[model samples]
Each structure stands twice: as C-alpha cells, then as structure tokens.
Target: MATFTKANADYLRNTLQEAVVKCSERCLYQSAKWAAELSVSLPTLPSVSSSFDADTDSQMQDVDPPPISPAFHFANNDPEEARLEAQDLSRYLLAKSYFDCREYDRCAAVFIPSALPRGPLSPTSPNSNRRTPTKAGKGKGKDSGVITEVGSEPPSNALPKLSQRALFLALYSKYMSGEKRKDEESEMILGPADGGSTVNKELVGITRSLEGWFADREARGLSGSNQGWLEYLYGIVLAKGKTEEDAKRWFIRSVHLFPFNWGAWLELSELLNNVEELQKVVPELPQNLMTLIFHLYASQELYQSTDPIHKELDELENIFPDSQFLKTQRALLYYHSKDFDEAETIFSALLHADPHRIDSLDFYSNILYVMSARPKLAFLAQVATATDKFRPETCCVVGNYYSLKSEHEKAVVYFRRALTLDRNFLSAWTLMGHEYVEMKNTHAAIESYRRAVDVNRKDYRAWYGLGQTYEVLEMHLYALFYYQRAASLRPYDPKMWQAVGSCYDKVDRPVQSIKTYKRALVAGTYYDQGSSFGSGTTAGEPTGVLDPETLYQIALMYEKLNQLDDAASYMEMTLAQEEGPEEDDDDEAGGHGIGVTTTTSKARMWLARWEFRRGAHVRAMELANELCQDGVEVEEAKALIRDMRARMESGRSPS
Candidate 1:
C-alpha cells in the first residue's frame, strides 16, 4: 500500500537501471553468439558490475586493454546502442510490474523526463568529448573495420529517450489513477469543497503532455503504427472536455491508421448515432471487429430480422466455438427474436455450466417471465435468492418475480436489497420505482426514480418513471421536464411522446400539446408492426387506431379554439374507432338507470353537439332524444335539445 512520490524516486531509478543492465547483458551475450557463428571475433564484453552509481564521477574506471592488431576485428561494440535498447526493454518490464502492483501513478512517474535522464553524456561538459588513452597509445589510430566496446560512459548522442508509446501509457495510467482518486475523494467529502479539482488538474496536465508529444511527432514528419495509438490517446484526452467533435475526428483518423484496433473501433461506434453509421465501417473491419459491431447492433435493436445476426453469429461461432460470451449474445438475439424455447435452452445450459453467472440468471428470469412460465420463474427466483443473496442481479430477479405476482411489499424488499448491493444499479432503482408506484407510495417512487436518473441520465425508463409519478401527483411542470428528458433519450418511443403531450395539455400549452401528439401518432405508426418488444406493453400492441380518448380530448380543444370543422372531423374519427355499447343484462345487474352512461352514448352526445353546430337540428335532436331515453348523459341531452328548440323558435334556420 506504499504510495509513489518524489521521496521514492531514488529507489525507482535504481530498480529501473538494474533491469536495464540485466537486459543489456542478455542482449550482448546473444550478439556474441551470433558473432561466433559468423566467424567474427567479438570483443570480450566487460563484466557487468553488480553495483551502479548515478553520479558519473564516482564510478570505477575500466582497465584499458592493448589495441588489437589490424587482422583481429570486433563485431557490434556500440555501447550507446546496447544501452538504448536495454532501456526500452527495461521500461516494459518496469511498467508491467508497477501495473501489476496497482501503482499506476508510479508507473507513469517513471517515464517522465526528469525521472529518466535524457542524456547520459552532457554536451556542455568538456569531459564528454575526452577519451582516455592507454599506456602504449599516444594518439588516435587509423580507422579500422573493427568495432570495439566503449567504456561505461555513453557518447553525447546516447540519450535515455522514452518512446511515444511509453509516454501514451504514462498518460493513460495518470488518467486512470486520477479518476480512481477522484471517486474516492468524492465519497469522502460531505460538504464538497471540490476535492476532485486536484484530480482534474492532473488529468489536464497529462492531456497537455500528450498534445505536446503529438505536435513533436507531427513536426518530425513521423507516421507509423504508433501514430494510430497516438491519435487514439489524443482522442481520449479530448473526450474528457468540451471537444467531442475533435475527439471523434481523431478516433476516425486512428481507425484509418490501424483498422485492427478494437479500442478505436469501440470508441468510434459509441460516437455514431445509428447502425447506418456503423455499416459504413463494417466492410473494412476484421471478423472479430464485426462481432463487436453486431453486438452494438443487437443492443440498439437495429436488426429487423434475425437473419443477419444469425449469419454473423455463425461466423463468430466458427472462430470461437466454445466462447461463452458469444453463446450468451446468441441467446440474447434469440430472446429478442421471440424464440423463447431456444433462448431458454441456451440460457439453462449456460446456468448449469456456471450457476453463479449473474447475467445469465437475470436474462433467464426475464425470458421465463415473458413466456409466462410462472412456476419456473418462481423456482429460479427462490434458488437465486437463497444461493446468491449478495448479487444485485439475483435480488433483481427475485424482486421482478414478486412484482409480477402483485406482491409489492415483498418485491420492494428484494429491490432495496439489490440497491444496497450497488447504489448505481440502474435497473434495480427503476424496478423499485415500479414497485413503489404499485404500492401507491408516490413519494417513494419519486425518490427511487430520482436515484436511478442520478446513476445514469441516459436511462429513459428512469426518466419516464419520474414523469409518471410526478404526473400522478399533479406536479405538471415537473412531470413535463422529466417527460421531455425521457423523450430526448428515446425519441422513437411513442409512450414517452404521448406522456409529453399529456403533460403539455395539462400545463395549458395547447399548441405544443398538439404538435407532440402528432409526433406520438407518427412514432407509434412507424414501428407499429415491428417485432421489437417494449417494456411498456405486450408485443405488437395495436397502433392502427389512435387512442380514442386522446382524439376526443383533441376535439374538445378544437371546440375551445372555435375550430368547429376540425372538432367535428376528430369527433367523427373517434366515433369510427370507438366500440359500440354492450347490451344491458338487467336480470344479473341493477337495471340501466337514469345515471348510467356509456362510451357509445358519450360519442353520440358529442356527435349531436357537432351536428347542432353545423345546423343539422333534426339529426342532432334525434340523437339527443335517443341518449335521454337510454339514460345516458340524460341531462346533457336535455340541455342540447332545449337549445335546439330555442334556436328553432328564434328563427335560426339550419345553415
């Protein structure tokens, strides 16, 4: 648990240097073997010293040997080259060790210029150019083809340079460490005195360093495999701030450079709005990358038919026949496709193989519920609750089963347990809200939904739940706000649009209400026949007939606006879709009394009023008489008839 800091710099430096020396010795030994095989006399490498000194002046000097004859030649004796290669290899080892130890800050700190010296031989020093002379040699000898090992001192150009790849990793480590610290600090600070500012500052510093490295690479006109990674890292940095477009551009460039990069592909896929955008890149991607894209497609419900997904899954199965991840994905596709038997079979086998697989258990419970296999679902819930009570998914499945059985109190207990396991479990929060709503605890429902939105703002279900709870409480303005948010998250969901419209009407925003209703109609019709099942309703709920109640409300609004013709048109449409009244069973129930009213009677009353407005008094009077005799809207019918009579007596003839 020891933290990395400037105090530990010496130890870090010494450890890195030792690793470099060891790797260099191994490389030299390999070169010597190669030299022997080539029939060349390599220089007898000096014994690697056990101790290393950071200060140059304190180092023991090597004994200078007699110069070799012209016939004897040494091969590969560049000390600077060996040292540079050794430093690169050593960096990898050191980084891996630090990463394994979870000391990411130390891993990053080791690659900085101040910690790792840039130049072993300083050009500013006069001794840097000086060469030691042997007892038998007075001046420099003629140039020979022989390569000899230099002493421990490196040449002026032999700088301890860090590659951009290493620098990128350093930035990544710093960013991850900073984020972890930020989360921890956020949890500790009650009053919130901005403890995260320090972490943000660290992130900013790392981003600036990456930018500087990118600029240096550009100026040097360097383009290679590392270029892709550099761009990808830059994209990650840009994504941290208000530079999402720039981030996207850099990710695209990274993809162009390295098409095989799964990281870049995944990031790019997230930025895209739809599957069409993904299709443009699909052909260029490898099969493994295609599987990732297909997974995205499946998540978005972009596949209209299972054919394409099944084809892709077949290809993936060939590549990784025993991959549980792929098998689960295939099962999910089957579930979505409404092949419950197939989905259940695969999920059951997966659970049998790994009983503790929470995801499998969750999905299996869902499939069982959808299939109405109540006994199976209850058994699964009991087993999961008993064996894996600590798992959030297990609690969620148990809670869902109880909720379905209309046991709201028992359901809330399990849902709250799931939330206790992970406060940010979005599904549990949303489901708990549903249970609260069922229990008629509107305030608790609101709190649960608020927590869910806090966990993930993009979850449309949480926002919709908040809207519904607020609307039920007659908080129209608050309901409107959350409904709009839900609509933004799921624009294609007609239910969200309808909720927004209803809120608008409640708040007296008639024009906005009308527009939103039209949008709801369009959205409802667009996917009316699609097989995609939403949580709000059963599969393929009839959308051809507009909500009769909504149509009637619209008609009333039009009447208020003095748009008589439009009112009549909408009322006619409502009547056309509305079902006729049922026969009164006078023997079984209390007879149809004076106060009784029916949907058919209401439609007739509205139609009669519209007829009166259009000067069709005869038809209006006939409908009004029929409603009054049937004891349906009797008072309203009498009032309408009285008005028609008064009008006729006043000589207001039919127009």
Candidate 2:
C-alpha cells in the first residue's frame, strides 16, 4: 500500500494527470521512467496467502492494518485480471515508443486503446469485441487507428471538433509539460511534478476540435475559387519559399482580381513594380482609389517605382478638380517637373481659396527658389512667415527660400529659430549649413552639417552640403569621402557626380576628371530620362536649351587649336538658344536673352569678329549690320563687314 498525506497524495495525483494530458512520446517515456523508479521503492507485501498461521509473527496485526481495495486485490490474486491489465498498459507503452520516434500514424494507432479502456461488460470496447467476434467479423485490428472507426464516417467528420480556445489549451498543456524530449537535451531540468492540478479538460477538448476545424478549412481553402484569395495564399507560400518571381506573379494576380481593395493593390504594387501594370489598371480604377493605395505603399524606406507616383497627379486632376488634396499633388508634381509657372498658379489658387493652407505656401516658396524667381520667392516666404509660431520643418523651408535668394543673414535667423523649436531637426541643420556655405563660413557650415549628421546620418543632402563646404575649404580628400557617401545614396544625381569630378580636377588629376565627367554624363542621361524632361534630354530631341555646361566644356575643347569657325558656330548655336522675352517692347532689342541682366551683345560682336576672320563676308556683314543698328557698343563692326565684303568680292580672300 502507498503512504500518502493529504498534500502528497494531491500532488502525486495532479502530476500524473498532467503527464497523461501531455501525451507527447517524450512525456510518456519520461513518466514511464519515473514509474520504474518508484516501482523499486514500493514496499512488497509478504506472500503468506490466505493461510496466515499463528507462527508467522507478522507486524500487520501489531501495527495498524492497511485498508484493502479491489484495485489492490486485482494486483494480488487474480492472474487473469492481471494479464488483462498488463495488455491495457501495453498500449500506452507502444504509443510512447511510436511518439518518441515521430511515427505519428503509429502513435495515433496505439493511443486509441489507452483512451477507450475495455472490460468484459463493454461491448463497444476493442478488447471486448476481440474476445467475441460477431458473425460480421468486426474488430480485426484493435491497435491500427487513432480511435476505432465510428460507423464508417470520415475520420475528420467523425472526430468531435475542438474550438480555438480548446486548441489553445492543448498547446498550453504540451508547453507546460515537465518532460523533455530526446531532441531537447540542452533544456533545463524541471524542478518538481504536480499531480492534483485539474486542467480544464473542456477547454483542451474545445481547442483540439477547433484545430481540426481550421485544418479542414485550410485544406478546403487551398482549392478556393476566388482568384484574389488564391493569389494571396500563393503569394504568402511562394514568399516563404524564397521564389520572388512566383510571389510577384501571385501578387499581380491578386491586384487584377481585386483592384479596389487598398491592401491588395498596395501589396501587389510593391512586389510587382511593373509600371505598365499600374498604367493599365489606374485608368480603370475609380477616382481616389490609386491615391489611397499608393499612400500606404510609400511608407517604405527605399522609394521604388516613381512612375505610379508621377502619374497620380494627372489622375487626381481628372477626378477631384478643385480638391485641396488634388491641388497639393499637382503643385508638388509641377514643382518636380520644373513647370514653375503652373505650380505657382495652382499654389496661388490654393492660397486664395484658403489662406491657412500652409503646405501650399511652403511648396510654392520652394518652387519659386528652384525656378530662380527671386521676387516671388520673397513674396511667398513673407506669406508663410508667422507672427505666433511655426513648425520646425516649415521654418527650415522658409530658411531655404531665403538662402536660395542669397539672403544668408535672414536665412540664418530662421534656421536658428527652427533649431530652437526642434533641436534635432536635421533638415534645418542642413539648410543652415548650406546658408553658412553661401556666406563663406566654412567652419560654421561644417559644424551645422555635423549636427545634421548627428540627427540623421542618412541625409544625403546634408552630406553633400558638408562635402561642398570641405571643397570650398580646399580639403580635397575629405570632400571626396563625403561626396562619395552622398553619391552612394543618390547615384542618379548628375550634379553630385559633377561636384565629384570638380574635386578631382581641384586635386590636379585631369584624366580622372575626364573619367568622372563621363560618369556624370551617364548618370545625367539616366536621371534625365526618368526626370519629367526625359524625352528631350535623353532621346536626342531638342529642348531649345544649350547642352549641359559639362558638354559645353567638351565643345570648348573643340574651340582650341584655331578652330575659329567651329567655335563661332557653336557659340552662335548656344546664343541662338537664348530666347528673348515674348513681351518685348521693340524688335531692335528683340534678340536679348530673357531673364539676363547683362547684355549678350559682347558675345554677338565676338561671333561677328569670328565670321570676319573666317572670310564669310556676307554672313559677317549681316551680323555686323544687326549689331551696329542696335547701338550696343559694337565698335568698327560696319568697317569690318565692309572690308570683309570687299576682300570676298576680289578673287583672293583677306589674310
């Protein structure tokens, strides 16, 4: 008989119950090991049988006799009952063995007998049926299933389905089990066992049922009819498999099936960056649908697929003509497109409609500076300037407007004010550094850029500004490092490469300068192609503007070595691109460059001189006459044209 106090008995019983619920092969094996240990420690009863003679001086009478129960009696005298009990225990042992080996099928097969015990009176029991087979020859294999078949119904449908809550309990029971698996030898040993803990069996059962239900549901979902659902499912699976192309295909399919769903469209747009896909789907979508989807997608750090974003403004214009959101989008796009006039018009309209539209004012000011419209930039800066208070970013934007307008002192004031509001504002620090750079304050600029980098090391503009400051201070190597860092972040920026090439030129490496210039041209081609002005800049189409200054340098190389005619032709071609103001007061001054304060008659006179030297008398005369008629300080132009024409008229040209 086992000795037990109230606490000890409760603890042992609770521990045993917990072990049974775990049912893992490892847990079962561990429990059997514990049972084996306890078996050796059990007190064996003296086998005197029913013939207890007086000569047998046993202490059972002297000491308190233990209570006898049917359980103890079955273990002692009944050989047949003992044999049956032994068979019942064999199922648990076999189940544990199968489970430890990860033979789920076999483990489940042996687990049935342990769950459904059999006795002589039990007709539905496997062992009972085995004792007496009906004429139908039932119960052929007792240990071959998770449970005996319930009247030929499918296994899934036949089993009682558990709910999610019940499944959770089952998982928790497995997690809390004190036993360690063979594979988990590195885990810590459990402190002690508890037996009397009554786990909520109902919860566990419900959980198991729910797990089975979800598994069935998932299986059915695999053959789902909805294309969107199927695509989403396949996308997740393919993504897990690391097949990005297959994942992309499914993502696109999901968008095709459900264009209106924001989540689906965004997810597909992110993975499948095919601009043609967006272009095809955008027009078919309802108004504002694309906007909602893209706003969510733009949250990623790397800004991929700019085509959809660039087209969003056009779509918004068609949909919400007078909407504030549409107006802002158009303003931003126009600013990027360098259509400052249109951007100004839109932003002005927004301000007229609502004076408190701060974003319109800020973007309007930025476009004004970028377009070199100084007067308008000043006006808009004043418009956004606040008497009460402003956000740090807004103040930084205002400071930049002033800085671009060459008002460094005023820019510094606003930049300082912005830093006061938000000390960690990286853009403000960057703008302030640029202002310092303009003011030729290299130390101040360096310190400002340092503060900017402290706030945000990834800010390419700040790094570029810092590099520019170093370049100005004649620190070529330091400038190179900072410029390289900035270029890595924004490799598409041609200006950055040009700056890098200039640094090389500063260091007396002309060949390296030439190489870097070529690299810049390549980047410029790519950047311009993707830019709003791509078609004209990259496709050999004319934009009525001179070739870039870097290209002009190459043209200069052609100018050297007495290529006077070629130089004059290129210079004239460059000059021809300079359009006069459309609202000119007089045609006599019609050819003056628009927006230029200085007269370009000097360049015109030089071309005329070049023509005279080349012996193109008639062309020289024509240019000379135009320059002389304008009274633009062209000395002896008439005399030169007359002399050149006279020489050409003669058989020999003038030397």
Candidate 3:
C-alpha cells in the first residue's frame, strides 16, 4: 500500500474494474481509472519510485482499458470513429479518474503545460519522473514502464495536435479548483451563512490569464490546435461574468471553429435570454447539426408553446433516429409544458432502457411529485441516490421525496446538501425556498429564492415563491413586482396572472386588476384545453372551465366604477358558475383564491342588489329570500328585502 509503480497501479485497476462489472456500477469504472492514474506513491504515505526506463511509456501507450461501446446516444458517430474515441479516452485515464473523484487540483496538475520531454533530457532535469525515450534496439521497452503526463500532446497522429479533450479538462479543472478554493476562502471570511456566492470572483483571474495565454500563442505563430476549446473556456469565464456581448462573440467563435462541440452550442443557447434574443441569435449561428440541436433545446426553453417544437424534434429524430438525447429532449419539452403524463411515459422508457443514465431523473422525480405519485417519486429518489449519491441531481430527488412527505426540515437539509455539492443547482435553491416557506422561515426563503434567481432568472417558480413570501407578510407592493416578474416569464400560466391580478386588487388598482383577471380566465381555459392556438385572447373568452371568482371580481370592479349595467351582467355570469350558496361576511367582495374573502352568498346578495337598483323588485325579493334562508349574507339580504317591500308598497317598484 505504501510504494507504487506501474505494476501496482495495474493490479489495483484490474481489481477495481472487476468490482465495477460485478456491481454494474458505471461511475465506479471512472473512479478506478482515475485512482490507478494517481497510483504512484505520495511521498507522505508511500515509498520512493524505482528507476524505470523509456520502454514503459510505449508499452503503456499500446495498452488500453477494455472498450465500452458508446451508447446509442452517440449513434451519430461511425463505428470506426467510435473505436478511435474509445482509444483516445483511455489515453488520459489517470487524470480522468482524478476528475471523476472531484480532486480538481490533482486533476489540473497532471495536465499543466510544460516543455516536451524529447528523446532525452539531462538527468538533473526538473522533470526527472519523465522516462528517457527508448530506441528500437532496447528490447526491454516491452516490460519496463514509467509514468508520464496523462494528457500531453495527441496520443496518436490522427487526433488534434493538443489533445483538445485533455486541454479542456485541464483548463476546466483549474477553473473549478479556483471556484472551490474561493468558496473555501469565502466561507472562512464570510461564514457559511453568507457563503455560496454566485459571483464567482475567481473566474476573473483565470479569464485574465487566458487572455495573456491566447495573445502569447498568437504572437508566437502557434498552430490553432486547441483554439476552439480555449475560446470555449474563455467564453465560459465571460458568460459567468457580465461581459454579455463578449461571451456571445467567443461562443460564436468556438462554434464556428469546432462545430462538433456540444458545449459550445449549449452555452450559446443559454446566453439567449428571450425568444427575441433566441430568434436573432439563431440566424447568426452557423447552419450545422449542432446548431439545429441547439435550436430545438433553446426553443423548448423559451417560447412556452411546445407543439411546433415537437414537430422540429420529430424532424431531427429522422436524422438521429436512435438518439437517446433527442428522446430526452422531447421528454424535457413535455416537462417544461407541465404536461406531466406524457413526460412520465417517455422518461420511464428512457430510464428502463438505460438505468445508469443520470441526466434527467431529477426532472422525472419532479413530474411525479407534481402528479402526487409519491411511491413512484420515492423509488426514483432511491434509485438516483444509489446510482450516484454525490451528484447534485440525486440530492434534489431525495429532497423532493422528503418534501412530498411534508418533512420540510429533512427536505431543506437535502436541498442544502445539493447546494453544497453545486451552488448553481437551480432546482435545489428554488425547492429549498419552498421548504423554508413551508417552515414559515421567510428570511431563509427569501435568501434561497434570490439565490435561485441569481443562478437562473428563467426559473419562474423562484420568482413566484418570492412573491408568495412577500404576500404572506402583507407586503403587497413588493409582492406585485415579483408576481409581475413571474408572470412575464410564464405569461400563459393562469396562476401567475391570477397572482398579479390579486396584487393589483390589493393595491386598489381595480382597472388593472380587472384586466389581469380577464387574462387569467383565458390562460386557465387555454391551458386546460391543451390548445396549440396562439397566446390566449386578452378578452378571456372562456372555451372551457372558468374561474367564477374572476367573473365576480370583474362585476365588483364595474360596480365600483358606476357601470351598473356591466356590473349586473358580470354578477349574473358569476351566479351562473356558482355551485352552491356561500356564507360570506362581506357584501361586495369577490372571494377569489389569490387574495380575497369569497363566499357564494355574496354573489347572490350582489345580484339581488343590482336587480333592485334596476327596479326589479320581485326578482330582488326572491334572491334575497334565498340568501336569508342559506344564512349567508343574511343582514344584506334582509335589508334588500325590506327595501324592496317598502318600494313595492309605495307603488314605485314591481309595476
């Protein structure tokens, strides 16, 4: 266990791989490969290395781990190409293992730029660990091996000059290590309570260094080798910072130079914040397969309607028919639409086909949670946690399961753990806010909601949660802003519109309230009918189920503005939708669910009053009598009856 060498690393790797196969643990293989790469003894724990010759490097280069066929997700790649990729993957097994282990510092160290070790170097050379290049005359090259850089230049002539994968890994590992180190420092300085910043201050330092590195390379007439990847990483640093236009430029450069890189396309897609931005950026994107896929993903995220996007996805499937990525995209599109049933079906198939896949199971859990399928969600949580307990997604699934059980405290713990694992976990922050709200910890909920929005402003739930917390505190003005933001993000969501309408009413802006309520009615009917039609009409012509409270509010607003005829008409519409009498304490209030005291009796009472005002004494009397019998709005009903009776007796009514 103390001293390590090529043989010791090989032995340990075989042992670990055996366990991986036996347990069917895919992540374990990654762990084992990384472990073996770092198998050389550390001075603190292991004995010194023995003198090894250059032949070891060539022998190790020839040997590769057993090939694992890339899944159908990469079916787009040719078989020959896939084989080459497998070999390329094994080239840096040691560093890859460290990355999988989350040892970013160690991972970066393995790929740091250094002078190439040519056929020979001085014995006193700084890199004594590097092997002397063996000549063909040396027969011992077959048996004697030595450690070298995991991700140096290309392992084969066919690959890119700089080993782009290794270079990106090296740079990204350093980037992530900087983030980790900064977080540690921040925790020390600001304490955990104020830690987990979304600012990412360390990125600035890396970005500056990358700028200098690129300039030096250009000045020295270096080959473009990893130009695209370097640009992609640079774009990442800029994207995370506020240099919006600069980020876009580099992402474009990255995509143009390396059209096959999915990350470049994805980062560009995320940079587009709105449908307008998306459409504008789409034209700028080079017309390629990657752009087409990015277009589908971006469309799913923006424009709320997925009907057209489904057609687009179907078209893409024609090209990549067996692609699991496309299938998951379709599933994700459904999930975004809140069409849980369809989402559930597709996700279930995807999971069944590849149980070890970890991309979107947290999303599957969310769909189940929304559907109140507790047992299914619980099973998903268990499976996700078992697959990779350290993953942020797994923690989110566990958190959701606990949340469903009404275990708010446990839910918060898991969500916080998810945040600890990945501070940028959008779902964890939003869900944690929900848990805090359930616990009535408004301050904590506010912090979580803010952090969620800071990570990704597109998450409407976080905006809505902030509104809910403010509304609970009777901070109507603040609630109005957040609700409006949420509504703007999810314009078709009835609940968001209703919340906005409710806020307007609370602030006594009846005109605005009436307008918003109408929109809510349209959105509700539009969503319920699964319409592929355009954004619902603002007039809110209900084609299906209607919110009677919204109707009642419209009447109340009309009444307040002295539009008596309009008031009576809306009040009658409200009465048509009412199922039974309600015991209302107030006379003119509409009991909408968002922010009102509502009772069925109030609608009846208001209708009766409106009828009496129009000189319909007999109609008013009948409605008032019913309200009195129902014991709701009794006082208002009695007064209406007496007024009608007196007016009738005076021969000024019921003619």
Candidate 4:
C-alpha cells in the first residue's frame, strides 16, 4: 500500500546493501552468514530481529581461519593488495539483502557514492578539485543490530569504503518501521554538495535519481523545455549509470518531461520493469500520444518477463504520496500487470475523485476482461448508456464483448441498442444475426445477416453467416447463392469452398459436389494465406472418410436407381458414422462379405417379388414366405409377406 516517488529515495534504498557493507571491520566479517539466514526467513514473514542477532557488535571468534595470502603479508604495500578479501564478501551480503526487500533505490543510492565517490559538482559553478558527499551516513552502529553511520569524510584517493553487512540489515529494518529518516535528510539538504570538482563519470551513474528529477518537474507542472534538467538526464543515460539509481532517475525525468515520448518511456519502463506508469501517463496525454503509447506498450508487453512493476511503483508512490492522480496511475499499472484486484481498487478511487471520470470506463472494462467480471461489464454498459447513448460503435463493442462470452440475449440487446443509435451500423446488424443464430433462431439470423449484406455488399462474414443459416434451414438454393458471393470476396478460404460443396450435395448434384470438394482441397492448400492442414490434423494427407452429409447424398443416388442393396449400405454407413452402430448387421449382410451380402439380398427380394406377381400360387407362396422369413431387407421382406398372406386368405388363384 505504500507508494514511492522521488528518484533519490528509490535510489538510496536500492543501494543500501552496498552502503551497509562498507561501514565496519566487525560487520564486514559477520554480515554474510547473517544475511543468508535472513533471506530464507523473509518469505515466511519471520521477525527481522529473530532472524539475526541485531545487537551483536563484538568481533566474531572463529575456530579456524583461512591462512593469510602472500598479498596480505607486509611484503606488499600496494593499496589493492592490502585490501582484505573479507570486504568483498561483506558487500555481497548487504547488496543481496537490499535487493531481496525491493529497496533498489536505496541500494543504488548507497552503492554509487560509497563504491565510487564523485567530486562535488554544482550546477551553477564548475569546479575541478572539490568533491561533495551529497547525502552521507552519520556513524558506525554500536547499538544491537543497528547500523551506526560513521560521519561523512572527504573523498579519499583510496578505494571507497564498502558498508558492513549489518548496516544494510539495519537500514532495511528502519525502512519497514515507517521511519522518515531519508525524507528528513532530503529536506535539510538545500543544494548540491560542497565539492567543487566535476565528477561527470560517477554523477552519470545514478539513473533512478535523475529520472525522479523529471518526475518531479512534471508533478510540479513544469514542461520538458527545461534544458538544464534535460542535459543532466541525457548525460546519465548516455553513460549508462553504474547503479540502478542513475538509470532510474534518467528515465523518470525523460518520461515526465515528455509524457508523449514513447521512446523515453519505453526505455525507462523497461529498466524498472514497470509499465503501469506508462499506462497512467498515456491517457493523460493527447490522442496522438495515446496511440503511440498503445503501440509501444503492446509491442513491449509481447516479450515475457517476471520482473514486477511493483518495484517501480513503490518508488513512484514514495515520491508522490499525496498526488490526486496517484490512484489513476496505480489503477493503470494494475491493469497492465493483469492485476485486476489492484486495478479495481484504484479505479474505485478515481470514481471517487470524479464520478464522471472518463478514464474510469476503460479501467472498468479492462478489469472486466482480466477478471471475467461480467457484472463489471454490465456496469460499463450502464455507464455508456448513461453517457453517450447514441454512440453505435460503443454499443457494438460492448455487445461484441458479451457475445464472445456466449450471452446471446444480452448481446442482442446491445446490438439492437447500436442499431437504434445508428441505422446504418452494418456490423451491428451482422453481429445481431450471429447472436440469433447462436440462439437457433434461424429466421431472425437470416434477416439480420441479409440486412448486413444489403448495407455493405463486401461484408464477407455477413454473407457467409447468412449462407450458413440458410443451409441449416435446408434452403440449399439460397445457401448456394450466398456462399458463392462470400467465396468471391475471400476466394482463398477453404471453408467457403466446403460450404459450397455442401450446398451442391443438398441439391442432388454429386458430380458438382465432388468438383467443389476438389476445389476445396486445392484452396485448403493456398487459401487465406493460412495453414493448409485440416483442423487438428497434420499436412501429410487429407485423411478421414467422406463427411456424413456427403454420404447421405450418395445413398440418395443409389435409391433413385432402384438399387436397394447399395442404397441400404450407404445409408447404414451414414448412420454408423453419425449415431454409431445401433442395428443388426447380420441380417443386412446375410452371412457373407458385408458388400456381397447386401447385393445378394437385393437379388433375392427381386426374385420373390417376381414370383408373387405371376399366378403360380405354389411357387409364389414358397418363394415369398422364404423371402419374408430371411429378413435381410426389412421393407422388401415385409411387402412380400403381405402379398403371400393375402393370396392364401383369398383362396382364389392365391397369387
């Protein structure tokens, strides 16, 4: 819930680790083990004091120590050689702790100057020999677990002192305690440090701090034309700050000065891994600005990374804790991060800020999308309805979002709303047609799709949609006509070709259907600039049997020719594929090959019918009875049974 703002604050906290390790000899030795233990316990919310003995100020006495290297012997007087190996170990521990706690700004703040001190350079006066300790620690810690800062000293020619490991542990605790030590320090420091020397190299290293300068300027309503600030920022980024602070400051300033400057925003955001700030800043700019911002954000969000924007946000919060725009900014951040909960929290705040706040609509819609918050969508609908009720596009978009979720009735309501607002909203009419089709209201779907085509002859989807609805309704002629038109618009889509084949089959045109299917196969390969393969299948071959609908057509062809056996086989195949096996195949197949038996039964039924037609009563009776009992062809067999029984009962020539 806490917010960070200023670059310097964020920088200092981020660099605290490096600062702590530089403090004392005793801390330099013990901080590593202490820091490692603390890191493991942190996620469990362990009490900080219990994780390490905060009060241990005495030197640690070990059972065995490593032998001193030849470099550490009195034989070497080089400052670098005399440097204890223990110092490097201590710095590593302190830095690790600061990083874990997300106090990156502090870590950088401490690390930059302590590890690499710069001669103090005032903006107004140039100097050569002077160095400024802008913000320095007080003394080394003697208190239990507390880091006492040794007072600020002149810039030394020797290697800069690294903080003791315990120092960072102390700083982190101070930060969590809600202490305002840093803020108090910032207020007391009136101007640049008293160093007269220009240390451009190290000064350029503090990125986050410089970024904060620009953030501050924007917050104060100062525009980007401030040349002095611009030059300073460009310098830091140009050098690529040695600490995160240098980078952070440069980016923040650049973004704040030119909110519409997507290049600057992107570079800065990328470094901090914070996109939320850009999200907030985008809507605040002009339409052109928002457009550029959208393109940039969308492009960058495409790349995957786990770095949380919350770190940058924390820094932003600390700097502008009381800004009225903070809520909107926070909400935008949450939305981009896909954190709907936090986004909603900030959106609620924005609404409180202004019930009619325009950005709230977008924020609410985004949350709805992210969280599947349908109720929030309804709320968005209400808001749009209450405001610009005559915006057809608005209503259409709202409707489409609902339709995607399969709320057809609700979708229709919005689609109708859009139609009422703009009589010529062809897309809305088309969408309404689709919604009706989803509800199985074919008549309505047809009318709506027709209206869409009538409004815009080139609306291919609308034409295709109409053809589909007609096909479902068994209007093959009409389906064919619409499908042809749709195919002409998007000639490469194999689906359109397939639909054309289906319509041809429905009209009892097998040759045409086969031709259409062949065309579909060709189109499947090169159509729509898409993959040629069938759904869920590979590209090697177009496998699988003919579609059920096609099989039905084949059966019809056999029936027209009086080929009962062939017709039955095809029909059985269709049924088998559609509803699975449900009938006795033994009767149909007649104890033979499935194909041969079907033909044999056809021949037997024909002979029995012929015999009954003649007046030879004995023959008719015997053959008909035999055929009827066989039961291979149910319809034909039943007919023979009726004829034979009637002939016997009549007793007059019995045939």
Give the number of the best model, judged by TM-score. Answer: 3
Candidate 3 deviant stretches above 4 angstroms: 1-101, 110-167, 186-202, 217-227, 529-543, 578-601, 625-655
TM value for model 1: 0.57
**Candidate 3 local lDDT, 294-355, one digit each (tens):** 78888876745566677777755643445667788888777666666788899999888878
lDDT of 4 by residue, 1-655 (tens): 2211123222322222222332222222233332222222222221111111112211111123234233322221324323533445555556556655656445444444343323223443222222211222333422221112244222211223433222333333323221132222223111242111213333422222333333344444443335222422343333232233444544454444333223344344444323344455444433422233233333233221124444433433333343334345556544433445666777766656655444335336535544556676667667666767667756765875686587889989878877665545666787788789889999778878876765566566688898988889888999999998877755546667778877887887766775676566565544122221112121222223333444444555555566656655655555344233334666552221122234445544544554555555566556556555556676667776776777668764533
Query: Which tens-of-lDDT digit does each residue in 599-654 have in candidate 1?
Result: 55776798897788777888889989988887868998899899889988998864
Question: Residue 431: error of model 4 in Å?
Answer: 0.7
Per-structure clash totals for the candidates: 0, 14, 6, 77
TM-score of 2: 0.40
User: Which stretches in model 1 have alpha-carbon errors above 4 Å?
Assistant: 1-103, 106-170, 188-201, 227-231, 257-263, 273-458, 462-485, 488-491, 528-536, 541-543, 579-605, 608-655
Give all TM-scores, in the order shown. Answer: 0.57, 0.40, 0.70, 0.27
The parts of candidate 2 lying over 4 Å away from their true place are: 1-308, 313-327, 357-361, 370-390, 397-407, 424-426, 450-464, 476-501, 509-543, 548-551, 556-655
Best by lDDT: 3
Ranking by TM-score: 3, 1, 2, 4
Q: Is candidate 2 or candidate 4 better by lDDT?
A: 2
Poorest stretch of ten by lDDT in candidate 2: 126-135
Q: Tell me the deviation in Å of residue 574 in model 1.
A: 1.9
